[model samples]
Target: MKLLKIIIVLIGLITIISCKNEPKSLSDFKSNFYEIQHNGLRLGDSLNVYFFENEDLVKSVEIIWNGKLLKNHTIMDSTNTSLGINNLKIKVNLENNSISGETNVPILNSFKETLVEFEVVKEYPHPQELFTQGFFFHNNKIFESAGQYKKSKLVTYNLGSTNYLQEKKLDDRSFAEGAALLNGKIYQLTYRERDIFVYDEKTFELIETLKLPSILKEVWGITTNGKELIVADGTQNIYFFDEKFNLQRKIQIAGYASIYNQLNEMEFIQNKIYANVWQTNYVLIINPVSGAVEQYYDLASLSQTKGSDDVLNGIAAYGNNILVTGKNWNKIYELSVK
Candidate 1:
């Protein structure tokens, strides 16, 4: 009750202060939460949401949307949220220990429609029978990064003749998730490992290991844009780094599908970034400028699921066609834009 009284006094103080001219940043004033949506959302679909209270104090924020609470890792206080097309108001509660404040949330709609479709032409000629996490093409050659508990390896193969080119085994049990050639070295990301394996590009020999940020260790995918190296982690955020491996600004992919699809294998093509959602047969083509997903390719038919085969694990651009493959699949297909 004492804290409530203090809050009531502060509210009164703010009300009086607002009538006079004042200088304040966003935190100094009550903020309104705007609803975000795009044209790609389906009816009954939900997405992740974050709330801020103060500087360096953004933790578990409870939100009441359409009179229901949510319970996801991203939103535990949420249970019943809106979906499809509808306008709703949300009450954002910021609990600062004993004192709290309420903010208003406004509803919005989708930005663009999502596209997902795929068809398996044939399997890759080689049949080693392993789960692939990353796939890249260079000069008609296919480079594959395999993932498993203890059977992980970085292998290269000739796509034209289906001949084994080379193989490099991991020293530790940690499986390699993604690999990219930057400058003349190969930088590799290890799943759940804070250590990054660097290799000589030409010889494919292990060079040295670099440690990632001390804060996070669950690295997932990696790619290069000629100048800087971009990476994705367990969280749906992408980080940029220079040749020295210094931490740069992070790009947050905020959307309904971005919350849990688990962005895997990343590939840079024609100034855009392409990533595949793990365990699903879909590839997301994103715009680096706005972090908006421009287009999506559905690879559901590649692996054979309920409606189609599920071969949408890896995505790469070879010349003018886009090649997509999946875990333990035989065929690597070349697809034209639809």
Candidate 2:
């Protein structure tokens, strides 16, 4: 009888000890959860995340990404996430503790071959002396940044009438390239001077001079999506920056058959980047995030109208229209993309 009683007591003690070690919920051991490794992943790339925890105490594991639950992830294995243009939020659900974190993984867009051509809606007289590098439209007016030492200037003109409205001559040594208008300021890039000149949008007066990143040897073009500025040099690389000129990201332009280099003069429209290839009559429409060329427009016939020395350079979006011009070109062509 005593032996039987002792056996019952031992079994009950074992059951109690097992129940005490088992976690009822994650909150009981939340402090023990720790992230081992988390990394930023690119679009189309696999995501590998790791964490350390007491596996026996964990009742269940759930992973959530971008508000959606990921069902097929191993506890310590890498999982492929879907492609997107924004940041990713990850939430880990444990029986006792739920932890969350974020990753700044940029999912590059897939490539699509879209063929398009341009039809001239209207042709306006452009200044033949202005070696146009960058162009933009603001408040129904055309703003331009022209290059060439001692000749570089930022000028504004009335769109249809082509009447000169304002002009600001840069310093003799400054050869201006691309121009972007944001807030109430005009940001102009210099060719070899390695300076970004800022001006008052309304008055066209020089406001400040900022230094370019040392990695960029030549500033070719610049445009903005209202919040951030996108700049390009002579290479295939394009850079994204905040309004304060802080580097945010970089993209390498990829063409269908080759890597498109010598990208000059850019325009951002409808989430796509249109860039003019230096010394070529081709304009490439690129996916900004993925660096893939979705389509290209050949303006060889348009170039025939200009002088032999003129090179296709500038692009701008004005209202519902896109405009194209070149260095020393006498006319600006309004384009219709099909």
Candidate 3:
């Protein structure tokens, strides 16, 4: 009876040990136990991932993006990822030689391309000496900001007569780039000085000077959606700023087949941003929210009639008309979108 009791106790100990040491079955393992930490993901950004499974249970992990193997670890980097929708799959190899079920993640940014052309409606005389950078129309008046090392100026004109109504010369150090008229203020940008000059709209008096974020080395174009301001550098990125000039967010502007660079003067029309490609006669109509080029308008014919020194750069919208001009061009052409 003592031997029998001893044997029974030994058997119970062995059962407990076997249960504790046995590997978890496939059904017990959960796939995608990891969590991805990000509020939102954009193109040219890196995604950091975290896993919840025990390291001892995981032999290896594989991450796939858009049907391509991205990494073999928990953290996946999307630095060179392309724009648009992408599929992601995560697979984990268990220590017991079993694989977990694949986890599917959908990363998406809807971007599409559209083609557009324009018809000339009318032409208005523009000063040939003006190195036009920013152009806009408000209250029956046309406001233009011209740039050159020592010749940068903010000038206003009567829309009908094209006669100068007011003019203010910028300091020799300020190479003015773009301007936006909002409320009772006019905001102007400089090329590399990082200076944003604010002026009283009615009096043209200097109101204040604001500095841009250090990351924005060059300020090329600016526009407004009534409240917030949208700014562009020479690259594919566009920035949004609040009423107080605080950086809100940024997006990479993508075209049909490639990313649009050298984005210059900009104008806001019906929620879309119209920007001129520097040194090109092509205008990109961009959807600001998605950073997609909705349409491309070729204005190459307009430049052919101008002097060799003229380079397409300015755009503006007023009432029911869209106007386009260039640096030192003789005329501003009103466009009829077709």
Candidate 4:
């Protein structure tokens, strides 16, 4: 009887070991990488993701709320979104595509008090040189997308020269707004082109144009959040697309329980998205999961004129400092990190 019992115990141990599952790679599903603005997954909403691990196309996902995940869904942008507590739990499975981890981060009411003050210590040297709407400093190069509704252009501003290092004029009919470089190529969005244009980064050559979805009401600003590409419209909505540029998800920006303003020209920092609330002098830092405005930095004091662009438009980050410009301004000012 003792020997029989020993054999049974060994069998049980084997069964339990066989049932052990592969470890989960949830590091990617941790926090919000973009500011929670209209058009991202939020509370009561979820996103499905497919990725490869150990040479297998494993399925994993993230559930976001208020622009951040208090439990498992992650924001991979280099932004700082942390739970700071070990009380979080996540459920994972190897073969199950529906198994998910979800959570709601308690909206810290403190954001209303976390006063982030910006003194705009400096503005771009020539703030009214051109009607620049979008600005990005990529690989030590400055690419500015200009907008004039009927006279927009995509120009690479020469750091110290008045001449456009390399530029492309869009038929004087398409209004270009924000743009991004992906896989050695540049993608440009126009105000009313009803399409997005692609360019060869080195040649500044127009490669192709992608027609927006018929339902796409407008295209304003755009940037990549590492795993996906994000774009904004004149309204409060933002769109998410896969690597193939396929529409995957969307969210809207609202305030006081109502969609407040048009979200314009975007810059993704850390894991949060910083955007200009069209024609406003404030840069709103948003939480992507809860659609919550975690922080707002007043930039009305950033410029000498409030005199240049409409209010505020272009936003670009370099190291710890941020650079901002406007739609029809000539100079792009580099900002001091506050």
Over 1-338, each residue of candidate 2 has an lDDT whose tens digit, in order, gives 99999999999998888767655543344522222123323344444444344455544455555455555332211144333333445455544455555544334334545668667889988888888889988898989998889999989998765567998998898888999988888999998888899899999888898999887888888998888899988887899998779999887776534567789899999899999888999888988876878898888888834454589988988777799888988888898865
User: Can you give the lDDT of residue 34 in candidate 1?
Assistant: 41
Q: What are the TM-scores, per candidate, against the unseen true structure? A: 0.65, 0.67, 0.70, 0.63
Highest TM-score: which candidate? 3
User: For model 3, how does the per-residue alpha-carbon lDDT over 119-213 read when each residue is reduced to its tens digit?
Assistant: 89998888878899889988878899999989999999976565689999998998999999888899999998889999999989999999988
User: For model 3, how many clashes?
Assistant: 0
Each model's C-alpha lDDT? 0.62, 0.75, 0.76, 0.62
Q: In model 2, what lDDT does residue 23 have? A: 51
Clash count in backbone of candidate 2: 8
> Which regions of candidate 3 fall more than 4 Å away from where they truly are?
1-58, 62-112, 160-162, 304-309
Ranking by TM-score: 3, 2, 1, 4
Off by over 4 Å in 4: 1-113, 119-123, 127-129, 255-258, 304-309
Model 2 CA lDDT for position 323: 90
Model 3 error, position 45 (Å): 17
Cα lDDT of model 1 overall? 0.62
RMSD (CA, Å), candidate 1 to true, equals 11.7
